[model samples]
Every structure is written in structure tokens, then in C-alpha cells.
Target: MEISDSKKRIEELIEQLNKFAYEYYALDNPSISDKEYDKLYDELTILEKETGYILSYSPTQRVGDGILSQFSKYIHKGRLWSLDKAQSFEEIIEWHNRNVKAVMQYNKENADKLPPLEYVITKKFDGLTLNCTYDNDGIMIKAATRGTGEIGEDITAQAKTIKALPLKVDHKGLFEIHGEAIMTKEAFDAYNEKAEVKLKNLRNGAAGALRNLNLKETAKRNLSAFFYDVGYNEGDPFESYIDMMKFIREKNFPIDDYMKIARDTEDIKNEIEYINSIRADLNYDIDGIVIVINDMRTRAVLGYTIKFPKWAIAYKFEAEETTTELLDVEWNVGRSGRVSPTALLEPVDLGGVTVKRATLNNMDDIKRKNVKIGNRVFVRRSNDVIPEIMGVAEELENAREIIAPSNCPSCGSELMLVGAHYFCENTLSCKPQMVKSIVHFGSREAMNIEGFSEKTAEQLYEKVDLKTLSDLYKLKKEELLNLEKFGDKKAQNLLDAIEKSKECELASFIYALGIPNVGKKTAKDLCKNLKSLEGIKKATYEDLLAIEDIGEIVAKCIIEFFSDEKILRSIDELLAVGVSPSYEETLVNDQSSFMDKTVVVTGTLKNFSRTEIKDKLEALGAKVSGTVSKKTDYVIAGEAAGSKYDKAISLGIKILSEEEFLAMI
Candidate 1:
């Protein structure tokens, strides 16, 4: 064929092969056979060689033959901010409450009211974060890691190897898109089956592929990606997150089909639960659900914290179970004087964390699970909590039974068996128990005493004989100065911090008390319902159980805690030392039209933002429902209202327009 004809054929073949690759990788729906695709690809390569006319996006250039000497640094067009994390429903609720409060405060102060809070929920992909830059011609120029969020190592060659990623697009815009480069289970298993060195997990598989110097080795992993955000855009500004997502879809970027809009904490919780349930069955891995403010305006208002975006949070799911050999067992005493067995495990990576130790609960748990030294035990980690041994995964021939220690690990005191737990009754002399109690009392979420450390707590426990919780308040500059590394400035600062801790929130005070089964959220719930420390002290079993999130066990624990004479005396002493705990009431207007009503807001509103409307309804004491159901008292319909609006009309629920809602309020 002539050179001109070869060039023309090359262009056509490139387009055809690119389309086939996109269908196979991006859509997971291949229209043509692999044999046919290879035939066309071979022809394109031949034609390009004959004509010396090769496009930058040609499939032939996907994987470079030469290995890279080193990675070059590339500065990102826009900083990629990390999301604040939440592990439980309570944390999500707390984060949601903060968002609601911020929106309410902003609307109350400004003439132009902010919109209601709408969160975009997506999968928090368990992989490396990739930032891909596309030039004005819509051709991908650079791809980098989320190193420091500002600068990153160049991985353009490695990224191009991903068949799902678009090498060129049909647009004329300079932009940067954020995505997660993930290795599907299929890819991981396939690679591991033939390789000499096996991959540890899907996350490491993807991360290792992208960071590899050899392009051929990177291509062997067969990585996939899902773009979520247009981090930097120069063509057209998006009004909302939904708009940006739509733009990404239009540009033929591969995105997960699991995105949803959550209007309230309930919606978020439902989504989180759903994701957690389905994560195991998914071909790719996801560590959590990412909740982002949908509106760009709202995001701008919320802005970014020092390390994370205030408008977004990640509800991390429990880490997957992994098996590790139990090497030994060590007993430790906690703040409650309960001695628990901690299994020393052969170092294993679980959810990117090196887990060297796992909780064995107690002697009962160890016996029940049949966990023994030299046996491979199933370990699972939830959030930042210590990994727990679920059960023995594999029994070894030489495995030995885990024997319970008869004495305390800290003070060598006699251990007393209490139900399922072993306790050290010598709490007055046990150093670990006392030190831990002091540290817990001065924890950031508790009394929040600045400059408080484990070292300082140990020093106080040993040198100053800090025997009780109230003893911390009685600490003086002279006492602190006598300790090692305690200068005049350090001693003064410690004293000031201790003094400042005297005035604390009721919730903090309750949490600092170290009541068994009572966490920060539980303490906050108790403070909110009881209103005063005295009320909590006088609360009956039924009264404690009446509060939300408080179960029978927690109620019993609280009652027992207050019933203790020593605890009661400690409380009295704390009060006598000028410790004051204050509670702030969350007020609502009961007279409002939407008070205690379940209201659903849908579509775009002319006067208010999505979040603004929700916040306004919440302010009026309304429960904003994400879905339209028979329980919905009102459906606030706006322009382009879809299924929820239709469902409301069919259900014969009260419907209100923006004008009607404004008038009603």
C-alpha cells in the first residue's frame, strides 16, 4: 500500500482498537473477539511503521519497552485534600451534626442563605490515589500519585498501561482528574497464579504496579481505575458534584456505578451499611464509603481543614480477616484493672497496617476460640482498634494451649476471675492501671489537657504518687519540676493545662471518668439526655435505658459506676477541687410547620440550596427523609423532580413548591 493509504488506515485502526479496548476495560462489555482486536492492532502497527505516522494515543504506546531510571516530580494543578474519617454510626452522626450546624450558622448570619446539606456517597476504593492531567487537546499528559497532595512522582507511562483509562478524549480542556488505581480480584489472582513472587493484597498489587520502574512489569498487573473528581478544570466550572460527575462520564472516564446522594445522617448510615454488606462480593476492594458535600458552593463555604476537607468524610468499614501465626501471648492490665491476653503474631499486613499483636479478649475467649501458640489465627481489625483474634484458622501439630496467668502482669498481684474477665484487685499499687487511667482522663477527646503524654502520666504515677483522678487537679509546679525533663516552662505549662481541664463539658467529664462500656459517643448521649452530672448520678435503670444508643449492658455499667463509694467519693473530691461540668442544650422551635414531621426534599429549588432546605427543615424540628414513603408528611418538590416527586403524588402525600415551603415556614 502507498504511504498516504497506510497513514489513513493507521488512523482508522487506532480509533477502532481504542474503542474495542474501552468497551472491554472501561465498560466491561467487549463487542468484538480478542483475535479480531489483535488482527487490527497488528495491522495498525505495521501501517504506522510503514508510514512513520504514529499518534500519541495509539495502543502500541500503552507500555514502553525501556525501564525508567527514576521518577520525576510533578506539581499538581490543584491540591488533593484527604477526607476526615469516621468508623461508626455515631461518628457519622457527629460529623453530620457539625455540617448541619455550620450550614445553619452560615444561613442565619448571611443575607444569601446557604443551601441544605446534600452528600455524595461513593466507594472509598482501597488503592492508590492517582491524579491524571489532560492538556487542552484532551490527551493525557501526566499521571502522578497523591504525594503530599501538592507534588507527586510521575507515573504517566505506568498509568497508560491501564486499558480502562482513556489515553485521549474528545474535548479541548486542560484539567486534572482524581481517581483510584485498583487491582480487581481477577487481575490479582491471575497475576499471582503465574508469578514467582505473589501479591499480598489487591491494594499492594495496584500500588506496586504503578510504582514499578519497569513498564512491562507494571502492565503485567493489569490495573483498573475509577475517576471520581475533576480536581482542576479550566474549560467550564461545575455548579455541583453531580455536574462534575456527569462531565467525567461524558468524557468517557470509567466511574463506579455506586454513587448516591445522601440528604441526612440516616441516608448516610443506610448507604454505609449497604456498602459494608456488598464489599465482600465486589470484584474490587473498597475500605469504606466516602461522603462528600454535593454542592460546590457548600464545599467552598465548608473549605478544607489543615489535613482534610471539612466537607468530606470517609466512613471506614472493618478491615478484612487475615490469618497470622500466633507466636506468643502477653497479658496486660488496662485502666479498669482488667487483665487481657494480647497475642503476639507473626507480622502480617491487614488493611495497610502491620499488625504484630491481636487482642485475645480473655482466658474464656482464648479457650472458646481454641487459639494456641503456633497456630495460625484469623485476625480482624476494625478502624484504629487493635486487631482481634477471631478464631484459629489452622491448627499446628506442635500447638500448645494458651494458659491464663494467675498473677497480674504489672504488679504481680493475685488475679481474680470475674465472669469472662480477669481483674487485678491491687488497683492501688498496679502501675499500668494507674498510668493508663491518668492518660485516659487527659485524652484529647476527654479533658483535653494539653501536653499530656504517656511519659508524663507514668512520671506522675511514680514520682508524685498520683493515686486518684482528682489528684491530677492538685498537681503543682514544684511537684512537676522534680520530674526528669521538666524545666520551669514545661512545669508551668503542665500546671496551666491541668488548671484549664477543671472547666470541661459534661460529656468530656463523663468520658474521663472511665466508666466500663461507656465511650465518647455514649458519654455525649448520656450528657445530652441527662443534662447534668447530678441527673446522671440519680438516673434509674429505666431512665438510663430510655436514652438512644444506651443498651442494658451500658445502663448497668453506668449504674454500677455511680454506685461505687470510691467513685462517688472521687466525684465529690473533683467537685470540691472546683471541677465544673457544663451542658449546652440543643434548642428547636416546636411551633414551626414542619416540627416533628418527616419531610422529603427533591430536585432543584430556585430560592434555597439542597442543604439549605434540609437545614431549614431540621431547624424547624423536621426529620428530613431521603425517600418518599407513606411515612412522609410532606414532599418539597422543585424543578425536575423525579421518582420521589412521582411517588409522593401517587401516595397522596402533601406536596409543596419552593414558594409554598417558604410561605409555610
Candidate 2:
């Protein structure tokens, strides 16, 4: 193609891609399948490669090909102030009265009629605040984080990934837009499904994604933004806050639809209550509601405090937590024989969930939280995870400190402290340990045996003389029907589930073996390093130690697990019962430059995902390290490569860009 034609084609592709992206991400109405989009994107990429004519606005160029060395600072045109918090209805009323008084004083000075004071209430999004600046041409020029209200890290490239964030506005002439960058619940779930590092909450997911220097990583988070205010405008200012929002909406920016105008303090209270009532149903997380004076002139009259706006206040909803007295600590042994403490609490209702017991984490956490018997503690639940005791809410003078158990609760074996936790050395004989192992073996992430529970394991152990892991496969339907809650259908279903679990992946089966310190990731790593169960049985302690993230302790554990006679006997029995596990064969490119290279990747990369890059390096016979060391041959530094980058520089290791690494591959 001619240069002129290539340029035109690039522009056309950019427009077409942007349109599709906007429709799918912003409008939630995808006109074409992802396959169709990928084909078009591939064509554009080939065209760009041939002509060396990638457009600035091209979807392909949205993510910077290279990671940023450091975040650049950008000064805001106007200062961003935090709102004063109102924790109670009375406090909110006091703020409204203060605003009313200020407005009345202004009216008295002007000798004008007193109009009803109005306040605009918006949901206080639980996310990172972003400030965007548009140039005179109405094109987004820069975006920054809320660093210190006056200056922030320049994240224009990363911010562009937020599809709801308009790159080009209709009325912008050097104006600043302030919004909350958030990860919706749907997006968070979808991202976590495949993400190697799972985010704990939506707030952290959104904040971390924006702060990540890798534009591609930020894009993968599927973050959205809701514009709520204009921090600064170069041209004419709106007479009222509502008019300013209306102007922002007119510019095709994403304005929240839940914004309400409260005419009185009663209306404000009602709005707050309504917001709280529906908070659990919202797609995005919100911590509070922001109430601001509607009229800009009234806000000016109300003025500002040292750190907060006197005209506005944030009504923070109390978190779902309650104080309960710690009755005692129960030591429970798990599949790994790790004995963890559970806080037995005085029953309290927390957000409709009855809380009788909560995780104490470890003995160190109990000490740190100052939790003791007879002391009141705070319990908070996040997502579907078990509720945990946060801290001591009230301390009693006579409260006794929790003492570590000397012996295992399930078995009479002596307890040993391994790091922060206590463990039972007798792994197989302990009833709780064996029961937990059986339950975990049948878990969804492991063997995927449906309808398997701890109670069922207990029943099987007590009634069916289930002494070993392989005993689960030997259960007959007639035998299961004899147990409690086991009807004919339930027994058949359990039998079918056991049959189905027999054909699990090798990695899952390895994880189900319940080796100490061996999780899903470690099990998969073992499979990748050893290939099969036979290879695992034959692997030396040195061979196990050579794998990434496998330390001396894990290596010892793996060797001992494979060497145990009981475990070997159980494996033989399982194999005899038609239990066939499979492992995928990985193709290795031995001739690649990356072969035998000690490579460490840090930060975000545009060309490959976190897992994808690691897999690719491993496929090319490269050993990847979690941390930088002197032995590191190449440090593939991406955007926001913080401490690892600094360490690599200090160690005088070679650093490669994404493009450079791709070339070597």
C-alpha cells in the first residue's frame, strides 16, 4: 500500500476500533463479536507494522508498548479538598444548618428574598479519585491521581483504558474533571476468574489498577469512572453546581444517575436512608453520600475550612460490624495438620448474618488485636469469606490472655509452632486432620466431588471405618444409604461424584494429596517441574528445590510426602480403583536465547499478561524468579517496576523492554 493510503487506512481503523470499543465498554452494546474485533485489530496491527504509521488515537496505541520508568508529577489547576464527615443524622443536620445560616446571611446582605436552600447528594464512590484535564481542542491531554490534592502522578495512558472516560469532550477548553475510578462488582468477578493475583475487594482492585503503570494491566481491570464535578474550568463558570453537572453530562461524560436534589434536611436524611437501604444491591461499592450546596454562589458564601469544604459534608455509613465478647479460643486442625485458632464469640447479629465464631488468624494476630477471653471484639465480614475478629472493642480488667495449646486438639500429638501457626505432627491419625483432608480432596477446586461436606466425612469415618483417602472410592450405594440424610438418590449422586472425581487433572490430584505447604499454585508448579506422579516420586530434594518459589521447607515436605509408605499405599490403591489423572505436555523451544536464562519480570507489560508472560518464559526454558537477585540474568521491567527495578539497577543486571524481550524470544 502507498504511504497516503496507509495513513488513511490507519485513521479509518482507529475510528472504527474506537467506535466499537466505546459501544461495547461505554454503552454496553457490542455491535460485533470479540472474534470479529480481533480480526480487525490484527489487520490494523499488520498495517501499522508494514507502514510504521501507528496513529496516536489508534486502539493499538492506547497501551504504551513500554513500561514507564517512574510516574511523572502533574500540578492541578485547582486544589481538590476532602469533605468533612458526618457520622450521624444530627451531624448531617448541623452541616445543613450551617449552610442555611451562611445562605441567610448572604441574603440579608443583598436584601433579597430567601429562596429554599437546595443540596445535591451523590454517592461517595469507594474508589480512587482521578483528575482529568482537557485541552483547548476538547481532547483529553492529561490524567492524574489524587496524590496530595495539589499534585498527582500523570496517568494519561492508563486513564485512557477506562472506556467510560471520554478522551475527547464536547465543551472542554482547558477544564479539569474530577471523578471516581471504580471497579464494578461484575468486572471485579470477571477479572478475578483468571487473575493470578486475586484482589481482596473492589476498592483495592480499582485503586491498584489505576496506580499500576502497565496500561494493559489497567485495561484488563475493566475500570469505569463517574464524573461528579469540575474542579476548574478555564472559561465561564456555572452559576450552580447542578448546572455544572448538566454541562458535564452534555459533554458525554459518565454522570451517576442516582444523583438527587435535597430541598430540606428531611429530604437529605431520606436520601441517605434510601442509599443505605439499596447499597448492597449496587454494582459498585460506595462508602458514603456527599451532600453539597446546589448553588455555586451559595457555596462561595459558605466558603471552605482548612482541609474540607464548609458547604459540603460526607455522610459515612457505618461498616457492617458489631462488638462481641470473646468467650474462648478453639484450636482446630486442618488437612495440613496446621492447628489454627477460632474465636468463640458471644452471638451477635451482624448485617443479618449470625456470627458465633470468627477466624483469629493466628496467635500473633490475637496478641496484636489484644483479644482475650471476656474481652469484647469487633467482627467484620467481607464478601463471602468467613468473618474475622478485627480488634478488641472493649477490654476487661480480669480478662485472661489466650494461651497456645500444648497438644493437638484432635490427636494427642505434641504441638509445634511453625512460623505464626501451631501444627500437629500426626497428619494421618488425627480425626479432624483426616476429615478435613477428605473434604478438601472432594472440594470444587480439587477433585470436584459434588455434595461432599465435613459432616459427610465425619459420618463416613465413624460408621464406614474410612481410615484412608482411597476408602472414599470403595463406598457402595447400599453402604451410603445406611448413613443419615442418605436417601437412594443422594447415595447414587455421591457414588457418581466419586466416579467423576477419579478422572481429575494430575495437578488437582496432587493438590488433593494434602501435602504440607502445597497449595494449588505449588501443586501446578510441581507438575510443571516433575511431569507426572512417577517423576514426583523419583525427584530428589535438590530437584524439588530447583523449582521457582520452592524453598528448603517445601522441598523437604515434598520429599517426605512422596516417601511416606502410607501415602504411597493410598496412591497405589487409588490407581487400582481406575483413578486416572492427566497432565498436559508443554512444548519447549530449546534454541531460544531465553533458554536456561534466569529471568525476573516486574510490574505490568502491554504485550503479555502476568501469567501469559511467565508461561511463555517457562515454555522457552527460562527460570522466573519472584524477586531480584545477583544471579538474575535479565530483569524484564515493565511500567511501575518500583523496588525490583531499583534492586536490578543496584545488582547491575540487564533490563529488557517488552519489545526487546519479544525480539530475543
Candidate 3:
């Protein structure tokens, strides 16, 4: 091809690829397959090479092959103000009261009265803060870390790798946008699966990715981002926080879907509770909720403190992470007979719980983290339940190397090395293995046997010689009565619960089987798509990968799990004992107005909770979206609807009140 033709083709491919990326990452929708995307990307690379011309915004420039010698410093166009934090609801109340008082005082002093106190609430993302500057031509010129609020380390090359962040905007002005650069759980797991040096947590994964001198390494992290604030703008100023967010959205920046206007402390509290409830389910981590005054004028009146803006405060959640001394390491065997390392830590209060022990994962994780006894280590309470040692925090001269155990801790069996873990093949005799398996099989999310506990499982294993999951169904009330703490009532209740769990949901039963890399959600997804136990068992890698959220790792795990003869025999034994797993498709209201429509719900609904409303919409076959766009079929607006409602109106989309929505249904 000629140079001119190649250059034109390059521009076309860049535009096409960027649009596809925006759809996939920013909009959570993909128009084409990954294979198709790669094909275009390959063509773009070839074209750029042939013409010896590479545009700044071209997708080819995203992941540079070269490594930088050192990081250069860049001064921010505007100071990035830190938010004051509130640890308790009481503290948040106090902050709100102060804002209310200030608003009243301002109204009394000035001729102009500030609007009723309103705040914009968003998730306080637990990731590295990045500030990106776009020049007059709307091309991203520089990207830097939030260092000292005024000055930052230049990471323009590293930042470009975040496909969610746009390299160019339609706007014709110089501006600075601030966002949290995050590593999603999917990305984190994928990276750690193959990484020689494993990342400790999601926050560290993102921070280390951007700070790395090697651009290729940074790109490998597959960092994502969420833009919230336009710190500096050369164009016309925004009148309100809502307007600023709309502007950010208009520029096709990757903004988080959640944004709500809270009129009072009750609304803020409700939002906090909602976020906390779903925090574990989110793809990324959020440390807290941020509440900022919506009115720009009201913010001006409230002013700033020496360290933080008075108008905005972060309602901090209980600390999921902290540092504590690693006193020792304990090796334990799990249900799968895999021997794992658990760190014995100096007692520390984390997330309101006294944590003395944390999971060290495996020997490979230990070596990669470089954790040792006597070293101060970073510990995190994962999923608000399991305390996990993330990485080494501070190394000491007295630190001793942590060695993997040669034998099983529970049984005297020799440990066999497997991939990144050690396993004891004697699963039948290992007390911890059998006990844990029984306990897991009877847990709430699994078989959900009421009155079943670890103590109960241990007693059954030791006293009654309950050897397998199938043996639970054969348990007589007389057999249970011989165990410790088992009375007539308890024994009968245990038997009843076990009997009830026989007719269980297919998803829950699948979860009870303990497939690696498969969680409750994944199990549910499997049941939803595959529909039956036999179908799931026979599912090929291609079949499993065809389902959403089931990546190659998970697909491989599922295939391997079902391929095991012992597992198949165990499952067969359970099925023979009348353990009938059933799945029923959720019947939607096909006649409802929301059927097959894309709808967005905004603000506070008086009659329905957030979860309730979302459930209702799904039942009505509506695809509920977070942001309002041209494609939105309808927007259900409640009291004090903010940017989404406004955008819906501007786009001439249908708007419905709570009453109207109810009436339609």
C-alpha cells in the first residue's frame, strides 16, 4: 500500500478500535468478538509500521515496548484536595449538621439564599488516584499520580494502557480529569495466575502497574478507571456538581454508573448501607462512600479546611486492611487435602474484629510475597470474613525464612507438591480434610442444613466415624445422640435439616461439590445456562467458556473437576441417596411494559428499596442501566433525580414517576 493510503487506513482503524474499546470497557457492551477486535488491531499495527507514522491517540501506542529510565515529575493544573473522613455514622451526621448550619448562616448573611442542602454520593474507590490532562485539541497530553496534591509523577505512557480512559475527546479545550485507576478482580486473578511476583491486593496491583518503569508490564495489568471530577477546565465553568459529572459523561470518559443526589442524612445513610451490602459483589474494591455538596455556590460558601475541603467528606468503612507482625506460620489441610499456609499474626483489630490469624494462600504465594516470620506484614480481611496476609510490610533483621511443611499437618501422610500447593492424598483419614468437607457441604450457601456447624461436623467425624458427604444422609438420630452436645431436640433437628437439604437447588448443590475457582455466582451462572447437573458435568471447555464471566481458568477448573473419577463417584453416591438437585427458571412478566426494554432508575423511591426495584425491573424483563443515554428506552425517576434524569430529559427519552412505573406494570 502507498504511504498516503496506509496513513488513512491507520486513522480509520484507530477510530474503529477506540470506538469498540469505549463500547466494551466504558459502556459495558461489546459490538464485536475479541477475535474480530484483535484482527483490526493487528491491521492497525501493520499499517502504522508500513507508513512509519503513529498517531498519539492510536491504539498501537497504548502499550509501548520500551522501558523508561526514570519517572519525570509533573505539576498538576489544579490542586487535588483530599477529603475529610468520617469513621462512624455519628461522625457523618455531625458533618451533615455542620453543612446545614453553614448553609443557614450563609442565607442569613447574604441576600442570595443557597438551595436546600444536597449532596452527590459516590463510591470511595480503593485504588491509585490519577490526574490526566487533555490539551486544546482534546488529545491527552499527560497523566500523573496524585503526589502531594500539587506535584505528581508523570505516567502518561503507563496511563494510556487503560483502555477505558479515552486518548482523545470531542471537546475543544484544555482540561484535567481526576479518576481512580483500578485493577478489577478478574484482571487481578488473571495476572496473579501467571505472575512470578504476585500482587498482594487490588490496590497494590494497580499502584505497582502504573508506577512500573516498564510500559509492557504496566499494560499487562489491564488497569481500568472511573472518572469523577474535572479538576481543571479551560472551557465554561460548571454551575453544579451534577453538571460537571454530565460534562464528564458527555466527553465519553469512563464514569462509574452509580451517582445519586442525597437530600438528607437518611438518604446518605441508606446509600452507604446499600453500597456496603453489594461491596463484596463488585468487580473492584471501594473503601468507603464520598458525599460532596452538589451546589457549586454552596460549596464556595462552605469553603475549605487546611487539609481538606469542608464541602466533601468520605464516610469511611471499617478498615479491611492493616499491618501486623508475622509471629509464625501454621500449615493446615483443607477439604481438598491441599496443605496451605496460615500466618499467625500479632493480634490486631481489623474491620472491628480481632484478627490473630490470616491465610497465606500457598507456598508459592509465600515465596512471591517474600513474607517471613518477624516481619511486619500487610493483612486484609477478605470478604469481611477470612483474614488474609497480603504481603510483607516491613522486613526486619530478625526475620526468619518461612519454610513449607514436608508432611501434612492433620495426618502423618507425606505432602505431594502440586502446581502452587502441597496436598495429602490420604483424604479419608485426615481429620481436618473430612471435617472441613462435611462442614462445607452443610454450609448455608451449599446444602444449607440448619444447626450444622464446624463443631457438629467434627463431633460427627470423630465420634460417629462419618466418612463421607453421603454418610450424612445415613445419620440416625440415635447415632447423633451419642455425639457431644447432641440432645433429642438437636439430633432430631439435625436429621430434619439434612432430610430437607436432599431436595436442594442445583446451583447450591454444585457449590457444595467444591469446584476450584467456582463461587456461588459462578455456580448460579452454570445452573442458569447449563440447566442440569448432568449437563454441567458433561460441559466441555468450549461450552463453559461460552457462558458470560466463565474465563479460561474457571472453564479449565470445571473440566478438570468433573474429569476426576473420585469426584464423580462421590457425586454419584450423593445422587443415589435421594439428593435430588432441581432448577426452575424464573418466570418473568412478559406482558409488562418494561419487557425487553433498557430502563434506568434514578433517585429515591418511596415504595421500593434499591434491591427490590431492581428485582422488580428484572422480573418485568427490563435491562436496568446505571447511566441514561440515547439508547435508554425509559427512565424511572424518583424524588431529587440528578444527572441521569437530566440527561434523560435532554435526550427526549421517556420519563416515568413511581406511580407511572407501578401503573405501567
Candidate 4:
């Protein structure tokens, strides 16, 4: 019950909960009842309320409601779309009402009166959705799902075998099809029982089924699909949802009989109510109700929201149940030296992934979660990102008192609170902070020093009187060779790699300096105009503020870096040691056609990532915005075009579709 023992207890509970999540969600074969799971969840929830512990990965924080396969990276032909969630009934109704108005507005000019239209409501299966592309020959060429709604996975080899998918579609030239890949309850149980690492739920099973190496292997699983709609087509394939269903059925798709086409809000409500009532009885997974417009053309005009389609909405089903024990809380410092705390739970399985640590943003967050050692807490991980301690469960006031850390554990420096972080004012002198800076400098993205691993850096510091990173360049090859276990070959490689990096760009050098808040991209921008180390040193804070992405924090870091006599002396010493003080900027013609225009770079490029391209373009004085807009003179499209591509075309704005964008770059 002691606070010191809390870390160990939380780790244990995390393991247990992770196992439970694996059984319940990923495997879909629960050994315990829903009520039992809730009991465990309730216990943890109560503890979180008192102790303020939040593990980064908690079962309660996860979305997908279950485990999904580690999604394979695929170059999508079109960008995968993310859906906008509706939290309240009013929000859902308001969304529909707006869509109805928009659809009417679009058709108003053509006719005297708007046609009376009703939406078709169907079950929204909880399983991941896939967009399978079929050639006219009926061969499955590509398979993707809505990943950020821009680009999706290329699961062609895996999609080739999903049973409901036909070898060929009835009408296909270049056609894009949509469907939900799902695992049935029986198959989920059987797999959980037989498999070495049991899938936690049917969703996981479906995902696993998709990633299977062999078509035969995928076929071995009882996976099914309900072909939704053909998003892309050379021509009209079906007039209505009913017609589309019949077409897919004729083509050998396994359409679920429960798919009822409900027209009118009353009918939609009735269907949603019915799905919710019998949700537990269904053989396949149904997360909620999916409402779509029967008219494909009309659906197109309705367009989409930032994340989801504005034309339709999903009414989600309530989550089943879960539980876990709260044990302790821990705190970690980030790159900016911000101390963030996390809740430690007794081991728990979430969506097939082990959950242990959840974030407690700060002292305020700790109070919000109210977590404590030896108390029960409810937790959830959302969007597979950070988990939150939702609430506390049963109380254990008899346990030893829990207390937050007063000093930084790594340096034993007294902690000072700043915003949401507990800071150690000794940024330059803190041992942990010092080594972390050195590691950042030697990183591939920062300095590109291949042989300068963290282990070597640490060892060098201990073996010699190394105070700063500049000393690394001063180490003689023979001196390194004489070090423990380091022979001539390894030492020589390290020396050569270090020598090769001396000629690195000014931006990379800036990033390597380990200045606070100066990220890679920002560093690149700093050098784009300044071009030399001395230029940065000479520039005023006002001068730095002129550059894009150089906010107040970054500007402050830049000013401080140049002002520090130690940092300045270190750089002067590095240049004296044959390092590039500043590299000459590549001469690029400013008269280029795209100059002065705002652009957005998206999707996977054959040559460069969006970041790389953005860095390169900024170096040339071109503005690249993250989001697409009217000001977006060009959107450099890559393999998969997402909503941005559609948005650009709709606005009658010029677009450098991925291929064209690549050529321009």
C-alpha cells in the first residue's frame, strides 16, 4: 500500500487488464462476464479519482473498441477519410437537417419544388471498413480503408481472399468498392482458443484475417463482409441501395439479411432503436447504425465534414464493459523538460495491446483522475493514442498515503511547476537533461551521425572528461580504439561517419545544437534565409519572428542559444575542429511559376515525404500550408488523394495532383 510500491502494483494490474482486453475485445472470447469486467473497471475508476494516475496506454482509452491488426502501410490511390463523430442527438439531427437543406439548395434551380427524399439507414458494423478496387477483369487489384481519409493500406494480396468479395464485379472498368471486413462470433472464439496469441475481439480477427500471408490462410477464418457501396465507378452501377445490394448479391457477395432500407427519420430511428435492442444477439459485430442517401448523385453533392461525410451520420452503440485495479502513478519529462505524470494500473489488456501507463497531464490532471495507489480506476485509450483515467472506483483509505514527486528523479533537482509541467530549472546542469541533449544532437534526423549511438555517447562521457557534445569530434581514432571492446574497425567507422557529417547543412547543424523548442523543420526555416551560423547569431529576436513556424517559444530559444557564451564558444570550437560553420545555400531561381503561392503537400511521395518537401519548398521561399484552402494555389498530390483533392477540385482551384505535384517538386 506504500507509494513506493505503487509502481510495481500498477504494473501487475496493467498486465492483468491487458490480458482481459485481449480475451474480451481482441479475441472476442471473454473468460469473464460483462458484469465482472465492470466490477474491475469500477475499482480502478475510484482509485484514479483520488490518486491521479493515468497510464499512456489504457484499455478504457482505446478506440476501435477492440484490438485491430497492426495496419499495413499502403499507398492509397485515394486518401482514406476520417469520420466526424456525433456525440449528441441534437448534433446528429442538426447535421441531417443541414445536409437536407444543402441537397435541396443544389437541386432548387432545376425544379419548382424539391423532391421528397428519405435516407436509407442500415447497420454500421463495428469492424474496420475496406475499399477494394477491382479491374474490369474482376481481379482485386487494391484494398484500402479510411486511414486519415487521405491515404489507406494496399491490402490487395490479403483482400484477394475475403469470401464475400467476388473475383469480378458485374460492372467494372476501374471501380472502387466498399465493404466491412468482419469476424463472426464463433470464428473469433475458435481462433482465441487455438491461436498462440489470441485475438482480443472480432475486429482484431478481421484485421488479422486481412493481413494473412496466404489467401488460403485468410479463407481458413470465418470472416464475412457486407458490400456497402461502389464509391467510384465508370458508370452508374445501381440506382438505389436496394439495387446496389442486389447487384453485389448477384456478384456473389455475402449480404446480411438484416440490412433493411429504412426511409424517413421515423424509420431510421426505428431501425437504430432495433439495432441497439438486439445488438448483443447479432452474429456479426454491429457498432452502430449507418445512414446513407439512396441517390448516389445527391450523396455526392452533400459532400463531407472535416472528418466524416456531412451527407450521413452514424448512431453508435454503447460500449459493453471493462474494469481494472489502480496501483500507482509515475511522472516523465518531455523534450522541453516538461514533467508529465502517468497513472500506473495493475496490468490490463486493451484492444490486444498491454496497458500499463496512462497520462496524468499534470498536477491538475492528477486531481481530475483522482488516482491513488491501491485504489480501483476506470481507464480508456482513445484513437490508439494516450489513455485517460476516466474515474475512480472503490476507495482504499486504509492504504499508505500517496504523494507526488517533489524532485526530478533523474537529477534529484527540485521540481518547479510551469503550466502543466513540473520543471527542473537546472536545464543545462541536470545530468539527465545533459545526456538527453547529447543524444538528440547525434540523432539521425538531427546530426546524421550514424555511429554515434547513445551507448557510445554515455560511455565516452564516463571514460573521459567529456562535458559537451563538441568533445565527440575531438576524440582520436586510436583513443576510441583503446576503449573497452572497441577495436580499430569499429572506431575507424565511427571516425569516418563523424568526419562525413561535418559538412551537414546549416539547418541540420541548428537542430543538432539541441536548442529548446527548435524542431527539425523550424531549424531548416531558420537557415533558409540566414544561410550561416553567424547570421543566426547576429539576427535579433524580431528578425527570427519574421520566419514562418518560428513562434514566440522558438524565437526565444534562438535568441537564448546565440546569447549563451558557452553555446557560442562550443560552436566556435566545432568549426575550429573542421566542422562546417555554415554551408552555402543552393541557388534556386526565384522566378519559378509557383512562387508566392500557398501550397499544401500531402500523401506519400516517391521522392520525399510531405515534411521533406515542405522543408525544401520553404528553403526556396514558397509558402506551404498544412491544410488546403482557397489560398492553396497548388496541392502536391502523391499516391493517394484524400478530401483535399476533392476540395481543391470543388473550389475550382488549381491542383498539382500527386503525379503532377511530384514532377513540379
The residue pairs that clash in candidate 2, if any, are 67-639
- Model 2 local distance difference test score: 0.84
lDDT of 1 by residue, 1-665 (tens): 87888888887888788888888877656889899999998888888887789888899989656799999999999998888888778988898899899999889899988888899999999999999999999888899999999999999999999988988888898999999999998999899778766665788899999999999899999999999998898998999999999999888899987788889988988777777755665788888989999988888888888999988999887668689899999999999999988899999988768999988888866776778999998887655678888777799999998888899988999999989999998877899998998899999889999999999999998899999888998888899999999999999998898899898999899999999999987887798788999999999999998998899999999999999998899999999999999998767789998888999998799988875676578779998878666678999999977657756775688999989988887
lDDT of 4 at 106: 73
**How well is each residue in 384-415 modelled by candidate 2, as lDDT tens digits?**
56888867778899899899999998878999
List, residue by residue over 332-392, the lDDT tens digit for candidate 3. Answer: 8888888888889899998779999988888777888898999999998757678988888
lDDT for each residue of candidate 4 in 473-500, tens digit (9 for 90 to 100): 8879777876777998999988888888
Q: TM-score for all predictions?
A: 0.52, 0.53, 0.77, 0.50
Number of clashes in every candidate structure?
6, 1, 0, 81
Highest lDDT among the candidates is held by which one? Answer: 3
User: Model 1 Cα displacement at 645 (Å)?
Assistant: 22
Q: Stretches of candidate 4 above 4 Å error?
A: 1-324, 332-340, 368-371, 374-402, 415-420, 425-431, 478-487, 529-531, 583-590, 619-621, 640-659, 662-665
Better of 2 and 4 by lDDT: 2
TM-score of 1: 0.52
Lowest lDDT 10-residue stretch of candidate 1: 642-651
**RMSD in order of candidates:** 20.3, 16.6, 6.1, 24.0
Clashing pairs in 3: none
User: Model-by-model lDDT, in order?
Assistant: 0.88, 0.84, 0.90, 0.67
Candidate 4 Cα lDDT to native: 0.67
Candidate with more favorable, higher TM-score: 1 or 4: 1
- Indicate the worst ten consecutive residues by lDDT in candidate 4: 59-68
